[model samples]
Target: MEELFNLTYKDEVEILKDEDDFEALGDEKYLNHPDMEARLYWAFCRPNGSCEAQIKDIDPLVSIMAFNHSKLNALKRFTLLHKEVIENPNLRVKIKNRTRMLFRSLVDDDFKELNKVLDIVPVFLEVAVDQLKNGRKWNDIFADEIEATIFMQKAEKFIDDSFKEALFFKLKDLRELDQEELKEHLEEIIEKKEKIHTLILKHYKNEVDKWIEKSNLHLLQKMTIKKLAEKLI
Candidate 1:
């Protein structure tokens, strides 16, 4: 799956290359979904801008970059737009060349890494959605599976490929399994190797609306998150 922005599981990324591409993706019904419409609005409408110039005068490259920027949660987009450059330094230079003042005003930093903004959104999103402030990290859960897999792998005669798959996915809970001796052995491995998730939740923003209100965050970071939040909230 290759979703362009935040979504990781889409089968093919739908790139809005131009007016025609946007028209194809959008409809009256499409507007019903807040996120889709927000993406479209930020990407095309650019509610922040007040330009009335002719389409021919606007650089096409700027539109593409802006839309790509829109894919990031608004606040995060702002972060990368200023704090980090695009995957390419050239694209940042190109956008700066075209837009000139708007971006220059928002973020003046020269650093850029594609998806620098995107990476932070999910960290907050999971904390908010799942309320995972005090819990095991998912990677550690997967590590338990790894421990079990290594132990089981030694017994090639008994453990089949399907069993290995289930073990990896934790499709069935190992804790309740009937094999007590193997379970104890696996539990011991987990005890020694497992890492704990953090107790402190860095994201104190209870409402998505409040994410931008925190003063400790960089201004560009707040700007990026705030813009995306505006569309949905």
Candidate 2:
């Protein structure tokens, strides 16, 4: 179903005031042109461009472009960072058991063309990490936001690290579950990040108790042990 939607979206070439016969032509053109090139063609030539297409419920790329600009930029930056990470022989094999899509692809010595997946990573991460650094809510991060610029409507793990892992397999033309192992590795990374934030939010009763037993929350005197633990967990 999603594939069909993407195909339908790819068909909106030079949006017409009701074109007569060009549906066939556009279909042929799309079929012949590479998927990425065809999508780019629609963006540059369409009326009101990607903006108008989206307004009329046409283009979908605007979702990733219209609002989540930071994520897109981050992915491009990540490519550079990733290139550095891969060049280091010491770091190359470390994430072999990891799950994050981009990281897994970077480590894979045989994988080709890193650019295709770079654009999607940061866009997906924008929401997940938006709350991480800001200490502010979505209303603040996305305040005065333009809907046409955003791709997803709500925040969830669906667009998280696992998707990128799957994409690596697809892009590499290697059919199998090499990425499943990555999940355990990424979970370890997330767990570490959570430990630091636990101090702030004080979630997890047992973990907080363990930290408290170890004098971890001694500085947070104002917070009741239970209240503090809830945030850390």
Candidate 3:
């Protein structure tokens, strides 16, 4: 029994060490050790020219860093790095180079590390979907429709079914609403149809119509949240 337990313990430790090795390589290869700037650059860049791209690109490195260190200083360093990028446009070339190096390292140094990066994809996807439901701009929600669809496709990976269902229901509610009734509700909310409320209702109606035409339930839900937020603004 003792030998059996020892063997099991050894196997567990080996598994953990393998995980650590993957994480450490990610930190070195992608994050650019001792240089937070490089890390932030890698985190923010997107295939398209936009800073608002979901941090999903760098989430793997970030998650590994968080797991290894779990320290406030590390978190602060990352935050500052992101802030610096936000403040400086001149660093774009340098950042892009770092991203290239990081990608190269994965291909040339340790191909297995590439799998580690993909491991956190589901988690990042969950974050992106949650952001959309929490009222982020439609375009700002996910990196693209592909990412969103990937998340939806892997619904079993989601931990919070209630939240997901709530978002779905919210969208469904919007899609099912009577356009005439929505117009009346808008008038009641703003106390006049000739005011900004009328314009808002018109926009909402158009957006809903577009969603219906496209049969994009997720987008319809997001538009519903946007319409609700406009009422407060």
RMSD from true fold, candidate 1: 23.8
TM-scores of all candidate predictions against the true structure: 0.19, 0.22, 0.22
5-58: candidate 3 lDDT, tens digit per residue: 445323433443455364343344434334444444333331122222223224
**Predicted candidate 2 versus true structure: per-residue lDDT over 1-233, tens digit per residue:** 23444445434443432577554545444423455556445434443323322212222332222212222322343332333233454543442222143333332322122223334444324323332222222121111111101212222344445533332222212122123332332233245543222221222234335544544334554155435334334
Overall local distance difference test of candidate 3: 0.37
Error of 3 at 20 (Å): 8.2
lDDT of 1 by residue, 92-184 (tens): 455443332222221222102112322432222222211122222233233332333333333334444543333334322333333343234
Sort by TM-score, top down from the best: 3, 2, 1
TM-score of 2: 0.22
Clashes of each: 7, 17, 0
For model 3 the TM-score comes to 0.22
User: Which scores greater on TM-score, model 1 or model 3?
Assistant: 3
